[model samples]
Target: MQKQSKKGFTLVEIMIVVVIIGLLAAMAIPAFQKVRAASQKSAITNNLRQLASAADQYFLEYGIETITSAKLADADVGYLKAFKAVATESYPTDIESGTDIEATDVPTAVSADNTLTIDF
Candidate 1:
């Protein structure tokens, strides 16, 4: 008689591996989400800074105190070549000096009330 050898993992071993994988996933998911949210916030902040810089440049060149986001982001006559949104958010139509710019309807990942504001 010839002895037979098991070539694969047993059922219990497979179940243990699955449970370990599940636990690792459970531990990793929330951290990944937090990092993603932080990254989004940073991107949004950078966009706001770019907008503010363009606005400042426009002010210095044109001697204007107020400008629309659209005007700043314009291609032909605007300081910025183009403005990009990082997430689901809205930019102010009218941006003025000494006033803050706010992005509304931001994703829940970034904020609780779905809004982000930055001072210019």
Candidate 2:
């Protein structure tokens, strides 16, 4: 009689592998999500800085201290145009609201009481 060799993984071995993979994936997923959220928050901060700079330039040129959504809609300024474009149809209504920007308080770019804060 010829002896047979085992060519396939046993059921217990397969189950162990599946469980290990599941645990690794569960551990990695939450870390990835946290990193992604931080990156998004950083992007929002950079976007706000750009918008604030543009708004400052606009104010200097037009003698206005604020840039409303309506004004941004009407103007052809590069920063406003970029903000609208980057925001993708939902322009930020409050610069300091922390609704989308992900920050707790208004960024240093704008005043604390300012409502139309440049959000993400």
Candidate 3:
């Protein structure tokens, strides 16, 4: 009589496949998180730019110098009207932005320098 081999994978083979999959998943997860963080940073920087632009336009249109952050949320003539920059995640200020944005860079860019810089 001839001996017969198993048709399915052995226990060792199955465990090896599982470990490989887990390792692949572990490596892939961090990469995904890094990408997500980068995208978020880009988004926050863009928001800052838009907010600054809106303030510039508002000043140009109305000659207002002390434009408050709250004004940026106005839907009537605000640049960030659609975005609603007031909704901050961590801070109680006009915006949290989830980034280390320089407060000075905003107004200076809008009024003095007229240059938008994404202070990341």
Candidate 4:
């Protein structure tokens, strides 16, 4: 009589594979989350820089230091309309003004005296 070999994976082998997969996932998830947070921060910083540039242009053209409200007003449009419009479209869910902007972990430096500070 001839001896037959098993064609399927052994229980121990399967369990080991599952454990390894689980360990890999556990190690990767947190790193992925950190990467996501960093990406969001970068986007926010870029948006802020764009906003500051627009504010500067607005000030240069209209002689205003800060945007009137968190919302860009009509007078403020000429300075940052292009950039703001693009950012508004790209980050639709996160788009906000004033306090909401501050809530996104984006550092802000607007002065109490109404002067806008450009800081990233």
Candidate 5:
């Protein structure tokens, strides 16, 4: 009688494949988290830039030193739409030292150089 080759993978072969997949997943998860964090940081940066730009415009229009979050979000001026509906609260702080930028986290106001600075 002639011997026929087996068509299916052996137990060891299947285990090796599973281990490879597991290794790939383990490596991928952290990388994905990093990308997500980077994306969040970018969004926070954009938002801060928008806020600072609005503050600058408000200062130019009203000639005020300290511009709160309220006047910027005012519909008549429409300098910024960042803070609305949450009403009568303060502007969030901006910091760049976290895995994600929470709603409460935002950078300080425009600096003396007229640029937003991210606190680390």
Candidate 6:
């Protein structure tokens, strides 16, 4: 009679693999969250910058110091082609040249204070 050997992994081996996978996930999840938050913040900052630039352009073109967000975002004659909010943040309606533009109720994921201010 010929002796036969097991063809599959042992229970211990399977458990070891599961534990390794769990460890990897534990190390990865937080890093992924941090990266996601950073990306969101970056996108929000970019939106703020766009708003500032558009406000500047509007001020230069119309020779005015104050412009409303609605006017700057107007479809037909706005300085910006289109302004889209990246998150649930609210932008300032009244912007004055040489002053900072503030966005409120920013998503907590992007900012701790839930506010973003862009100085132009």
Best by lDDT: 1
- Sorted by lDDT (best first), the order is 1, 6, 5, 3, 2, 4
Error of 3 at 102 (Å): 4.1
- Between candidates 1 and 3, the one scoring higher on TM-score is 1
Which segments of candidate 5 are over 4 A away from where they belong? 1-9, 83-120
Q: Is candidate 4 or candidate 5 better by lDDT?
A: 5
What is the C-alpha lDDT profile of model 1 across 65-100, one tens digit per residue? Answer: 999888887778758767577888777888898788
| Pairs in clash, predicted candidate 3 | none
- The lDDT for every candidate, in the order shown, is 0.86, 0.53, 0.54, 0.49, 0.56, 0.85
Residue 78's lDDT in candidate 5: 90
Task: Enumerate clash totals for all models, in the order shown.
Answer: 0, 5, 0, 0, 4, 0
RMSD of 3: 8.8
lDDT of 1: 0.86
**What TM-score does each of the candidates earn?**
0.91, 0.62, 0.62, 0.58, 0.60, 0.81
Candidate 4, residues 1-120: lDDT per residue as tens digits? 999987999999999999999999999998996776566555655665666555555556766544542344345454444334212223223222332223132322212332223342
The residue pairs that clash in candidate 6, if any, are none
Shift of residue 55 alpha carbon in model 5, Å:
0.5
Q: Estimate the TM-score for candidate 6.
A: 0.81
**Cα RMSD for candidates in order:** 1.4, 7.3, 8.8, 8.2, 9.2, 2.1
The numbered model that scores best in TM-score is 1
Q: What is the lDDT of candidate 6?
A: 0.85
User: Which parts of model 4 are misplaced by more than 4 Å?
Assistant: 1-3, 66-120
lDDT string for model 3 (19-97, tens) is 9999999999989966765564455456666666666676677775646556667676546654532223211134333
TM-score for model 4? 0.58
Write the residue-wise lDDT of candidate 6 on 1-120 in tens digits.
999986999999999999999999999999998888888778878877988999898888889999887887788875776656776888888989999888898888778899988887
User: 41, model 6: CA deviation in Å?
Assistant: 1.6
